[model samples]
Target: MADEVKLYGVAGSPFVCRVKIALNLKEIKHEFVVEDLSNKSAHLIKYNPVHKQIPVLVHNGNPVSESLVIVEYIDDAWKGVPVLPQDAHEKARARFWAKFVDDKCIPAVFMAIGSHGQEQAVAEAHDQLQFLENELKDKKFFGGDSINLVDISAVFLAFWLGAAEEALGIKIVTKDKFPNLTKWSDNCINCQAVKDSLPPRDDLVSFFKMRFGKA
Candidate 1:
């Protein structure tokens, strides 16, 4: 019997993109169910009752919620190129950075994009970007030489960061300001596993414009 896999996600969501990247890396075949976030489907509610959020991975009948958790699940369930590191310390380090991307970088980026002309939010985002830049300065990738769970977790930096900047007419990551991060972003998005997973750039810009009421 073949394994059954289904993914419920919203269009252009960074979290959803994370799962998509992971599945693609693992070469896992699954059905993608795009959810109407404004009028979420009953299936999404049933599958993820607690958070009622998207990027739900339903495997063989069991549902997995939360993007990072679902990513770890994909790495575990499928035997392919490992997403998480094999060494114990390296795995822990990867998890820490992934969590940092989710907890720190994401919120900063959101605040910077959502709060127009807000000095504080923009500054916060800059600070976060600086931190990431410093971390990435001496490495090719967060996982060193290749993409990993940390890279997947930071997909927002790769795609949506640029999209948000373009849609809002605000520049966050730049060649001068965050040179390393800018290069890392390029490396990440250009990776074979991630290239096809991203939404079209123009579509994303339009989506952000409409989403932020700039359209």
Candidate 2:
């Protein structure tokens, strides 16, 4: 018998995109069950009772919640392309950067973009992007030649941030400010697997505008 894999997700969610990219990278066959976030399904609530969020991966009857967790799970469960590095130290470093993208970079980005480029928030966001700029200063991707856990984790910055910037009329990641990171973003979004997983740019831009009342 084959594994019964189902991903519960919303179309516009960057978190859901992360899991989708991971699945695509591994070439995992699964069902994408789109969830109306306003009226979440019983399976979503039952799988992730704590957060009741999308991007829940149900594999062979067991449930896994959280986008990053699901990505790691897919990488572990499937064996072909490695989303995480095999070396101990490199793997640890990759995990560290992915966590940073979530805990530090994401909040700073939201604060800056959500505040509509307020000086202080923009400064903090810049600092976060700069950190990534330094990290990606030499590599083609965060995982070196190919996408990895870190690249998957930072997909929001690669794709969704462009839509958010257009909708909010802000410029956080720019060629002048973050050349390396900007280049990396372009590469990530252009990667076949990542591109296949992203929502349409126009749709995402429209979503940000409406959701932020900028429409």
Candidate 3:
């Protein structure tokens, strides 16, 4: 008997994307149940009593909240094609970049979205993008040649950050600004699984515009 896997999440969420990408990488079978965070279902409340957040992975009737946690669980549960590197040191490094993308880069892009025409906010967004560009350093992916958890994290950023940019009418993560990162983002989107999973870019742009009151 196989474990029943279900994902409760919204389409636009990066948190959800992390789990989705992991499942795709492992070629795992699962059901995606879309949720409205504004009016959450009883099951979501039951699963994640604390955060009431999206991207809850329900495995064999057990619930796992938070994206990274769910990704790790996916990695642990499915032994083949591990997302993390085999070497201890390399694994640590990959985890570091994943966390970095989550912590620093995400917040910075978000700040720019929530703030417009503010000098500090604009500068902060630029700084964050520049930092990421500097970090690229000719790497094909954040996880080297293969797209691992770190690459997943960064791709989430690229997708949503592009949305936020269009929403804010700001320029960030342009091809000229961060060439390699942009290149890698394109590669990630073009990958068969990733492309299939991606929400249409134009639809995302429209969603962001509505979210930011630009529509």
Clashing pairs in 1: none
The worst-scoring run of ten residues by lDDT in candidate 2 lies at: 206-215
The pairs that clash in candidate 3 are none
Model 3: lDDT equals 0.79
TM per model? Answer: 0.95, 0.97, 0.91
Each model's lDDT: 0.89, 0.91, 0.79
Lowest summed lDDT over 10 consecutive residues: which window, candidate 1?
A: 206-215
Taking the tens digit of each residue's C-alpha lDDT, what string does model 2 give over 158-182? 9888899998888888899898888
lDDT per residue as tens, model 3, 1-215: 98799999988777788788889888989999999888999999999999988989999999999888899889999977678888899889878877888888778777777765366876786776676677667887666767777877777666777776776687755687678778888777776656656777777788777777543
Q: 2 or 3: which has the higher lDDT? A: 2
**How many steric overlaps does candidate 3 have?**
0
Clashes of 1: 0
lDDT of 3 at 139: 81
Off by over 4 Å in 1: 213-215
Question: Tens digits of per-residue lDDT for model 1 on 1-215?
Answer: 88999999976888999999999999999999999999999999999999999989999999999999999999999999899999999999899989998889889988888885378888898887787788887687888898999999999988987887888788766798887888888999999889878888998888778877453
* lDDT measured at residue 207 in model 2 versus the true structure, 0 to 100: 81
